[model samples]
Target: RIYVFYGPHGCGKSTFLNNLLTRFEDYANTEEGLRYEVVWRLNIKKLKGTNKSAMSLSAFEKLIQVIDPENEGKHDLEGKDLAFDDKEQEYIEVPCLCHDNPFLVIPKDQRRNVLDELIKNDEFKWKLFTEKQYEWVFKEEVCTICSSIYQSLLERLGSPSEVFSMLYARPYYFNRRIGNGISVFNPGDKPLRRNFILNQMLQSRINALFQDSNVINYLYSSFAKVHNGIYALMDVKSHNVERMVELHNIISEGVHKVENLEERVDCLFFALMNPEDKRNLREFPSFEDRIQYIDIPYVLDVNTEVKIYMDIFGRHIEGSFLPMVLENFARAIICTRLGKKSGAMEEWIKDPKKYQNFCDDDLILLKMEIFSGVVPKWLEDSDVKALDKKMLKKIITESEIYGKEGLSGRDSIKIFDQFYSKYAKEDRLISMPDLCTFFKKLGDQPKKIIPQGFLSSLLRMYDYSILQQVKESLYYYNEEQIGKDIKNYISAVTNEFNSVIRCIFTKEEIYVTEAFLESIENRLLAENADPTRRKEMREEVLKKYTTLTLTQEIMIEGKDISETRLFQSLYDRYVHNLKKRVLEPFVANENFRNAIKDFDTEKFKTHDRRIKRDVTFLMENLSRKFGYTQQGANEVCIYVIDNDLANKFKNA
Candidate 1:
């Protein structure tokens, strides 16, 4: 198979191929060995060729060399690892490129029947005959030289058994260092010149056996070295593009013709190419189907992108930034790679503005989260339910066309280097502000590649998220009291005003008046709710309590009123409103701001005891609940207060 990995430069195409080779080597070394014997890495520019004629071999002269009838051990090193220097001239050996398989020593006509009779495993025999790749074992003849030798030896000896005595098998060694099993060709390497090889002693023995004196030798070329192995071209451009064209016959017909002989090459062919270099193949349209193109686009997965950074830099780099701020930076870089619009995202989310607090208008942020293997909790229930397998598949499939533009892998590393060096400090951890400022100040040339307005949307999402975190960290309401309030409110809403009753769940006495109703209703309903809206909200709670809670959960099921679905809903609203207003008092207080800034320092203790306690609790909880350093917790609090986030989202 001829595979062409096409992508932008610095997109890790070579890294992927190296990893693949490592995996292949591991698999081949396991107990169950691989089917292929060797892998040859080739540089097309260094492959030498010629049109000159070579001397042919006579019957007996080639037979003795092929069969090695003397058992002289001249070719014993064919399978062994060899180490040689240029000074050691005697040890230097030319590779036998057209070496024949030991089993091919048998006459081609009778080989299959002999194998069938010798084999005992019926299933194994069936597989060898039926599998397409293994068909070569029975269907294909040996190299032309070996085939000619076998016939001549059979006729001269006049006995098949005598000719079979010379057949033997040797192990094949795969050494990457010496280019035995694996070889890599670079563009600057000079082409190999043609050479003819022969053994004098073996030729002398063959002449005595057949009494025919005809000197014989065979041609050797670079193509013969890579037969039945992996042949990879690093980059298919420059002189290599012409090499790819020369492979048309071998790739299509599975044969390489050198001089008058045909060498059958069954190798896994691979090439790495840039997207722009794909134009080099325009003159050869026939290569379109012959090559299998796999796109190695930019890293789209956020976790994967971060892993690359961690691999290049150190893993401790995570401690330099706030919890998700580092990932947010990754998201910002990925934003440049994505297209401005996605029809699949639009089909899933009809109104992108509804999630303005969490996602951008184009919903590229939302798509990125999905690509990172997260189904965001902020999505509306309707949209969440709509994300079935079919819709999710469509969304994921749409990502294949993205990551073609924007920042390359190298560009992201360079930008991260500049950003980290500029902002990472011993006094403070990297926060959202630092990230936003760094990208916002990028040169106009780089900024033009980024989708417009994505940075602003990202900042808004980060601000809203941190604001909520601060509210939840500061919120300290009694769980038991909130539960009792919900139960008492549901009981009062179902009954008439000014009525006195003992709360069934809380066991407390309550006066059901307008003031009592409005107290709990104020948290459940919006603060600006008018008379009709307040009435409708109270009635809705009452109807739910009577129909579902009282009938299904409380009475018939013998469940407590506090455990009803009605109680949980009212309880969530009650707690949410409490957390919403939890930051109101401190947002305007100068003392509170000072205490937060002074936190983790000696000056924090000099403030009022109440202020000091609140600041300590906020900082500690921010670190414990979210992954914030003490410095980060303090900085985020200052960020929230300085930006007036409390009033910004107070109505929300």
Candidate 2:
């Protein structure tokens, strides 16, 4: 498309034009006229502009004689074979010397002022008019940039590395010019890799080359050494000049073997000629199509997730000794940006309680990121409401199950599966983009979170997608085995009697209230005569309530028993269930058991180092078992697949 950037001077039209120049290094590197902003890359070695000396045909004719004094209009300059060292006789050197406003070479500061007076259009600065400087493009500034790095590319004579070595090893602007010595130019051997700064300044930019390409633009100020001189033709509309077109085309094509420093002169031909050919050039077959056009999600800009992952993981690794990350959470542990949810601690240091024989609800909440399961009493306090919307939203947004409702069945099922995946696996990053981390935005506020596990049940009952994963893990075991494993999982928690008692029965409100009671208790016992004279405390142990509610959870789902019966059963079997799931197995499994038992098994026994073999085994097994697969299984990044399959996409 034509981008006409015309306006009063200094309004950024030129600045925008410079930006446009940097758009397609990858495209420009191709021998096939890599068109992006350009219709086709062209080599115009004998290119000349119409200027002062070019104002009249005979003036251009005489100037050409200077290049080849022997040639008069009668001699044929067509189909000529001119070597790099050919006498300056083969072509004409037309000087654009117009003394009325002679072109003067001025230093950087004086360039604008000097040109303003001498190079203005005749009507504007009539006192002196040689030739208006055709748009003067400055060369790219010097950089540490190396030339293309594909060394294995069979280049003639000088190498890609050699080209880079010469260019970057010096401090000079870089541009195209007549190359000399030994080298083959054009897209000789390798492709270009983009340069970028570590800072996340760019949200993203499109590559006009190829859509599937992931190229990004990195602003750089470095340039290689350059050379500049103006070429002119007295008149383009003359027969003699028109007849020399073949000579120009020949010169443009003959020097394909030249170093990068020399090859650029070939590139300059089209640039200088762009004004004349811009329209016709764009009409080519290749110019109209795009191999790539970038689309950037705004999420890349916030980068809140990546930062959190780094910080949290750093702290988690530094302080944590006994790590018990679930296998699924292992890969999905990305989305390093934490606090995307809001109000959560920037350093959410809920230390690991593995190998300790008991799991703190807070630790579980930390590992599982299941906000509803367990959290610091302070996290859910009404005071949390005082936090800003982003913070408050982050707090309740942990698990879809415990967050607000009203999601479409598909969405509800999707979120639940993602949470379970991240919760099940450890070290694995959450397969989330920055956009996905949020509770529903209600008006400008986040909705209140219902109790944990509410959404999970609702989705399973409402959306059959709950079957998506269950049928996989339990696919091998019979109902009896599945039931046994389930019971085993539950019973493990009660292996620590006090742990079970403290967990299921401790209401968050009660724990917060106890912090107050515990403080008071210390005060009562502190005074000098407190032992004997303090108000008599109840002469009893801290007994716990026997009855519990399994009603809203089990009974609502109509799982085999009445509300009263289920709670009674939950209370009765709670001892064994907690022992099985939460404590015993955790204390027995090699990965996590040692953390709880406080034993160090030797390295070999604790290792999970079988990479390729296991990955292949897992992929084959999962594919055969689940009927989902992608091309290039081994080569593809599993993070992409995990994120896609989990459907954890949020605002992204």
Candidate 3:
């Protein structure tokens, strides 16, 4: 019967209304008639609007600017031509963000009120009595950027359709929240750590962009997005829109020249949507051609339905407006189509099978974009049910629901259930177990109709997948170096194993130690294999209060001494032992054969310059465990014996 418009600040309620109108014309009998609508007439001169603040009233009149979506780069609205005509149209308000403009100097409040009264003709309220249906207008809530002024503005604009006219036709509000706060990520205690971060931040690669403090600050923002994705430093809030335009240019340039993982993925998405970058690139010679996306006009009547398509659903789905370059693409990755471009303009352009610049590894990333939390409104709840079936099949398979090739229909339901249940409850920490079980407990074959939000949510969750990728990255630098890695890992895990073995278990649990002395060893031994169980650490009688740096040691040995590489090795070793240690006490075993099964210690393979250097380095650590000098080992007394329980009791 009618449309009601509302939502959170800056969420584009007005713009939503405009989009609805544009989509109307695009709809045919099948989608239309099925999608009903109404045509309403406006009795405008009679629209008496109430307001209080002098500045607010001026802002209210500035609503006229919503008629022009592209802000006319003016501080004040001294002369703008807009007059009310009683015309019938079936459309709603186009949601738009707040426009930032100075309020008019209207000190004469009484005169303003009188003028308001004349605009409201009492007889006009009776003209379109579906006036009875005004209350039922479609209303959207939870995301309008400016609720304070919306009410007064809504009244003047009259039901949503007229408001849609004002919004689609204009650029209304622009204001941003700005602040200065230094972010401290991953805090640590020791001086070395503090020194590391402090130094890195001082010479921050991100800071190279600015000389002017104001300009520099205006562009500073950081989001620790899915790990290793390109994080952007964009310009937002600069009064000069040129800053935004320029930033757009730099981002596009960076997209092609990506060298590090940090800049590649992050740069791709951040460059497109983030308004934070005060800069927009209007200068690139091929910018428009490459991106194939254009910001629509602020004014001039936009077809309401079509506008809705663009603002609500179109921009996101049409992510890579420029077609993917098919030749460079892997067949499994893209869905290439060989057809002449078809659109209203019919401008012949190539439409690549897949999206732009995509690769096979990026399939997960593309999927992640669907689930990234910031959802657009056009994708109503039902849309989530209609996901691309083929894509869903691939996604389900890729997620490794059972850590395998693909999921059956039954498997998919379970996976979706678990994923929804956990995320619905807000437990976003999905590890391998959670991932494997994400859809294992579902009971229904639910379908998606309005799937935009869910799709966005999935895509957005790419960060989680990115984090999972770090484990595999140990292979990235040297995939076959697993041989060197296995040895290093075995040793590291052994050291940790020794620490865990001494405290809680019987002597039988720790045979590698000296029967008499190394008896009460480290606590890691004899712990239960249940991952959820707490580890009862042993009494660490052998103190290890020390500091070590493998950087210089790594350099001297002629092995790449990257801290990331070293840490990754340590982490991998720990994980493997943690998985298998309960089943076998191979770590810290006296039986060198048992403990070093995979630890290839052949001098040529094992005792390379790097290994020798590391062994010598570790020898210092081993000596410290025995309270001995670096040159020798000092044996200690063992309190526990590895005999039968009854015999041990008799001896005691």
Q: Which lDDT values do the candidates have, in the order given?
A: 0.75, 0.27, 0.27
lDDT for each residue of candidate 3 in 1-652, tens digit (9 for 90 to 100): 0012222223333344334433432342233323221111212232322211211222333454445556455434567654433232232222211111111111123334443555565555443223655322222121112232234335555564453333322222111111101111111211121111112222221122111222111111222111112222121223223323333544554321221112211222222222333124344445444443322211111122223334433443222111111111111111111011112111111222132222122232233233232222323334335444654454434332211112222333243344434543221222222332332333333222112232232322322222122112111233335333333332332344434343221222332223312221112232323322212211221111011224333434444322334435444444433333221221233332221222323532443354344334333444443232322211100001111111222211
User: How much lDDT does candidate 3 score?
Assistant: 0.27
Cα deviation in Å at residue 523, candidate 2?
Answer: 33
Which window of 10 residues has the lowest lDDT sum in candidate 3?
Answer: 633-642
lDDT of 2 by residue, 1-652 (tens): 1122222222223333343443332233455523111011111121212222222223333445546755544344576642222222212211111100111212235445665765656564543333345323121211111111111111322443332221111111212233211111221223224321221211111111111123222222111111121122211223322322422432444222122222221222111111233343343435323212121111111122223333434433311111111221221222121222322533243332221212222333232333323333324334334445665456545432221122222332344344443433343332222112322322232123222332232222211222222123122224343233323322223233223222222212112232333333342233233533322431211111112223344445544322344324333333322222222222223443222122222532444444323333444544465433322122122332322322331111
**Total clashes in model 1, counting residue pairs 3 or more apart in sequence or in different chains:** 3
Candidate 2 lDDT (Cα, 0 to 1): 0.27
How many pairs of residues collide in model 2?
Answer: 77
TM-score of 3: 0.17
**Model 2 misplaced stretches (Cα beyond 4 Å):** 1-24, 27-387, 390-581, 585-652
| Number of the predicted model whose TM-score against the real structure is largest | 1
TM-scores, one per candidate: 0.74, 0.19, 0.17
Q: Which stretches of candidate 1 lie over 4 Å from their true place?
A: 30-177, 180-190, 195-229, 258-261, 389-394, 487-517, 538-571
Clashing pairs in 1: 39-230, 40-230, 41-183
Which candidate do you rate higher for lDDT, 1 or 2?
1
Cα deviation at 240, candidate 2, in Å, is 46
